[model samples]
Target: MNDKNHKVYLHKKKYTRDKMKDYTFLLPAGLFLTVFLVYPIFYNIILSFRDINIGNLIQGEQPFIGFENYQTVLSDPLFRTALTNSIIFTLATIIFSTSIGFAFALFFNKKFPGHKWMRSILLIAWMTPIIIIGTVFSWMLSGDNGIINELFISLGVMSEPIYWLTDTDTALLGTIIANVWISIPFSMVILLSGLQGLPTGIYEAAKIDGATRFQQFRHITLPLMKPTILVLLMLGVIFTFKVFDLIYIMTAGGPADATQVIPFLAYQLSFGMYRFGEGAALSNISFLIIGAIAVLYLYLIRKEEVM
Candidate 1:
């Protein structure tokens, strides 16, 4: 009886040890995610439903306000303008950044003299601090004595210096240009990695079969790179949608609310205007938009895999 009992006890201990080993691998990540990611998300959701403000924040009396803040944000003209600008900014960034990045990937993927140096230089824009980029671009696009205007004038392209960031019509465009400059490098790096990962034999086979470069790119390259391209597109849309620093630093969302995006609008509502509830509502809305895009991207990815 003692021998039998000893063997059973040792087996139970081994079983418990194996279970612990399985959980050990997941413990750290689970803890980190719960603390950092899950907590903030839940807190933000709670804040969005509350009438939180500076005073209430200090007093810890953040009471719920239902959907009143959301209604106010939806009805506001300023919010409408911000929504429009955000859509435009997101669309333009997606088009220009993705296209330019793909072009650069093609260029950089080839073995050429100083290719490494060229790639390093291109990545400088990505590596530079956003605040510095914003400040330098603001100075360069200044209406009066900006380098861009001076260059255009010297080249006789306009026959005069153009006020790039002063007019409402041009202000948003100027911000987009600055954003594109920063974003292109990211897209290029991602696409370049995808390009490099592609099997070379496929291209060689296509070439041997009398396929032209354009045909190969259209049929082979594009299809093969679809997953990577989708990821970049989704990321570009999300990043561009949340653009705040560049617009805030460059235009403060205006010459006349021309460059205001959802994030900037939320900032103004919360900090600048002291409407914390409305700011939270706007933030929630932005989150919804981005969340929707992410879901769509996931669906597409899954569908592609299924096909």
Candidate 2:
């Protein structure tokens, strides 16, 4: 009995020591996330409940108004418009980006001359800074000297050059186009990686069974790439929903708040209009929208794993 008790005590000590060593590896990352991610989230939550505008921001005597800020933000007409625009923008970007990216991936997946070179060239869009892309596209879409308007006119699509940025009707579309261009390369790269990682043995077996290329892609390729596709779509939705720089530089959310999405709206509320609490509320609302999508994605992934 004494020998058995001694063995148990020694085993417990060794297990604890091993657990502590494993925890040490995670300490630095846990601390970094707490400081940068957790602190900001909690700070934002606190600010959302208070009236901390430009005038009182410096004085720091913000009165806690509970849900008034959120109520005001939700009730605003511009909030409705921003919500509509955000959905349209996010959906449009995701659909076009993913579709085009998949098409590009399929084409490049085949062994062909200059395929590697072409793929690298396309990636330049992703590697370039967002601000630069926005700025350059702004010039290209200009009413007078813009290449897009000029080409459209030359092609008889329109009789005259159109103002892409200053017009309310076209501002959001212009921004989405720019966003799609940026998003495509990212999706392409991800899908290409998935494509390249597919089992060669399975494909060869399918070929031996006399499966057509389309049949193989529909039955095998898509099933295998489901995880990657879901992740890419989720990333696209998240990225497009929180888009800021393109809208800010290209249209500044407007001819009349036409291009304002939630993040830019939050900026307008907090910094532009000096309503910090309302801005924080909108920002938190944006987080909720993204969070819902993320939750749904996790649920799908869990179900897939279970199946």
Candidate 3:
């Protein structure tokens, strides 16, 4: 009995020591998250519920305003337009970018001359600064003296120059085109990596069995790539949802608010309009939407793992 008790005591002590060591490893990240991520999230939540303003900050007293800010935001037409645009932008980006990326990945997965160099060139768009891309695209898409219109006129594609940025119908599409150009490279790289990591033996076996390329891809490749596809889709959705810089630089959400997105709307409320509480509320709303998406993704991933 005494010997058994001593062994139990030793085991308990070892378990406690292991827990302490694990905590030590977690300390740095835990501290950083508390200071930066956690605090800001809570502070933003608090601000959303208050009557904070630029002047209030200088006065150092932000009175509680209950749900007034949220009510105002909900009643705003600009907010509705911004929300619609954000949804449309995100969905279009995910569909087009993922499809094009997958196609490119399939193409580049084959043995071809200059494939590596082609891939490197494609990645330049992804690696370049978003601001620079937005600025350059804005210049090229300009109405009268822009290179795009000039080339189109020279090629007899258009008799007169089209106003790409100023037109309400075309302005948003222009931003989408620029966004797609920058986004496809990222999707390609992810899908390409996934393609390379697929098991070669499966393809070889399929070939030995006299399987057609399309049939093999349908039965084998797609099933193997489902997980990667899910990840890429989620990433694309998240990236496009938060898009602000490109829209801001290109159109300033102008031409009658055609290209206004949630982030830009939030920025307008906070800085441009000096409505801090409303801006915070918009941010919180955006956070809730994104958080719900993240949670759904995590739940799906866990379910997949279990299956």
Candidate 4:
């Protein structure tokens, strides 16, 4: 070959080899996701279409019932209730957690005495396992001799103890409160990072412009923190929507299904009730809902990047 052609061939060969090495590095993670994540998702989709309850779950080649499972899940009154509760629970937790977390993030962003220590102390709630947090909250919210009740009585807020988990009126609200506490630290950390990353120059300029603290936050801080807030809300909704451990530990979807969200109901159907198809169907529905939200979030992020 000519000198130039030979050099070009060698360059192409080296490029191919380097690309192969890069693929090799990704192979393990790709295989792991295919095996553990992709396979199960596809398998669950297939399972949802089959008539495979406990009776015939072990048997091979179960009958394909098509949309029967979906119809059953969609038509159920409990499913409707669970859907509503899930929406309410997810929205409530995200709103309260993000608001409280944003406040805390702003507080800690300023360097003050013991600021780091206080921030670390607040993270304890998020660091603790959700089940443990739920258990502690369960005890605290107990109608009899609970600290919450004791505090309320002491302050004359109520003459009697409020049954948080046992009452239909307060069961979902109780779970929302627990979830908000658990979620706040994560939101705070994200927002805090965003806040710390903001340009001091802008804030100084705003101060020089005679802007008040609230005016600076509303005009400068919020606009700069929009991306971080979007990411936090997206992640918070996805995580909170699938919350099962906390609810199971606390109320078990009790008090007349007051706190029966979709994830818990899916568990009840698949394992508790042994209705595999229905459970799979319910899970698939939730997956679609989350999937749509994730797609929208990604699109928004891409748009922002383009901008």
Candidate 5:
């Protein structure tokens, strides 16, 4: 070969080796996704179309039932209750938690004594395990000896102890209260970070122009914080949707299935009743819902960028 051709060949060989090395680094992640994420997803989708339950689950060959499982899940009354509870749980968690979190973010933004300590205290609920939070809240809302009932009665807010978790009307609300509390710290952290990143000079300029706090927030702060709020809302929705441990530990979808959200309902179908196909179908629906949230998040972000 000519000297220039040999040089070019060496360069190409080095480039190929570099590319190979880069791909080698990604091999582990590729395998992990294929095994743990991709395979399970495809298998679950296949399961959702089958007529397999626990007894026939391991046989690996089941009768194809097309959309029968989906139809059954949709037609089931229990599924309707679970869907309603899921919606209520998601909406209430988003509204209350984000509002409280925003309030906390605003409060902690100001310089004050124990500002760091007070802010850190808000994260305790989030750091605590879900089961622990569920158990503690369960105890705190018990009809017989709950601290809340006792305090309410002592303060004349109520004449007697209220069955917060055991009553059909109140069971979902009990779970919501706990979820809101659990969710707030995360939202606070997100909002606080967003607040901290805002240009202080903008707020000062707004103030100099005679803008009130509400006006500053409405115009300056909110427009800047849209992305952060989007993330907070999406994450809150997803985390709230996946809440099975908390609800299960506290109420186990009890009080006439009042607290039975989709995840817990899926668990009931799969583990409790051994209806793996139906459970898989329900879980697929849940996955699609979460995926929809992600799509919506992307759409909003792109729209905002265009604006």
Candidate 6:
């Protein structure tokens, strides 16, 4: 070959080798997703369209029933209740957690003695295992001789102990309280980062213009933290919606299904009652809802980048 042609050929070969090396580095991650994430997702979707119960899981033909499983799940009143409860639980937890977290973030943003240690100490609740938190909250909220009841009685706030976990009226509320407590630390850290990222110059300018602290926060802080707030809320919704361990440890979806959410309902159907098809369908429903939120989150991220 001519010298120039040989040189061009060698350059192309080097580029191809480099590209191949990059792809080779991605093999482990690709295999992991395909085997664990992608395969399970597709399997669940296919299973949702089948009549796969314990009776037919092993030998008998697991017939493809198309949308029958979805139909059954959609038609169930308990499914509706579970959906409603999921919404309530997710929304309430996000609202309370974000609010309290923002307050904590603001408080800690100011430099003070022992502030760093205090902030780190608060994260212990968040870093602790969810199961442990659930168990602790369960004990604290117990009706008979629980610390909460004892404290309330001593304070003359109540003459009798409230069955926080066993009574249907208060069961969901009890779970929400636990979840909010667990979520606060995450929210606080996220908002604290956002707060610290704000331009100090803008606040100084606002102060020079006779702006009050509340006014500066409303005009300068909120607008600057919009992206952070949006991302935090989206993540909170995604995580809180799929919560099962806390519910399982705290109430077990008891007190007449008062605390039943989608994840717990799916667990009950599949493992507890052996209704695998319905369970898969319920799971797919949850997946779709979360997927939509994930899509929205991506869109916002792309928009921010474009801006």
Which prediction has the highest lDDT against the true structure? 6
Error of 1 at 136 (Å): 1.1
Top-down TM-score ranking: 6, 5, 4, 2, 1, 3
lDDT of 4 at 81: 97
Candidate 3 residue 24 Cα shift, in angstroms, is 3.8
* Lowest lDDT 10-residue stretch of candidate 6: 52-61
lDDT of 5 by residue, 270-297 (tens): 8999988999999999999999999999
Return whichever of 3 and 6 wins on lDDT: 6
Decoy 2 TM-score against native: 0.92
lDDT tens digits, residue span 111-192, model 1: 9999999999999999999899999999998878999999888888887676888888889889999999999999999999
In model 1, pairs of residues that clash are none
Clashing pairs in 5: none
TM accuracy, model 5: 0.96
Give candidate 1's TM-score. Answer: 0.91
lDDT of 3 by residue, 134-243 (tens): 99998899997889999999999999987898899888888888999999999999999999999999899999999999999899989889888888888888889999
Q: Could you tell me how far off, in angstroms, the CA of residue 18 lies in candidate 5 after the best superposition?
A: 2.0
Model 4 residue 112 distance off true place after TM-score fit, in angstroms: 1.0
Give the C-alpha lDDT of model 5.
0.93
What is the clash count for each candidate, in the order shown? 0, 0, 0, 0, 0, 0
The local lDDT score (0 to 100) that residue 255 gets in candidate 1 is 82
Model 5 regions lying over 4 Å from their true place? 58-61
- Alpha-carbon deviation at 230 in model 2, angstroms: 1.0
Instruction: Give the 10-residue window scoring lowest on summed lDDT in candidate 4.
Output: 53-62
> Which ranges of candidate 3 are over 4 A from the true structure?
1-22, 302-307
The Cα local distance difference test for each model comes to 0.91, 0.93, 0.91, 0.94, 0.93, 0.95
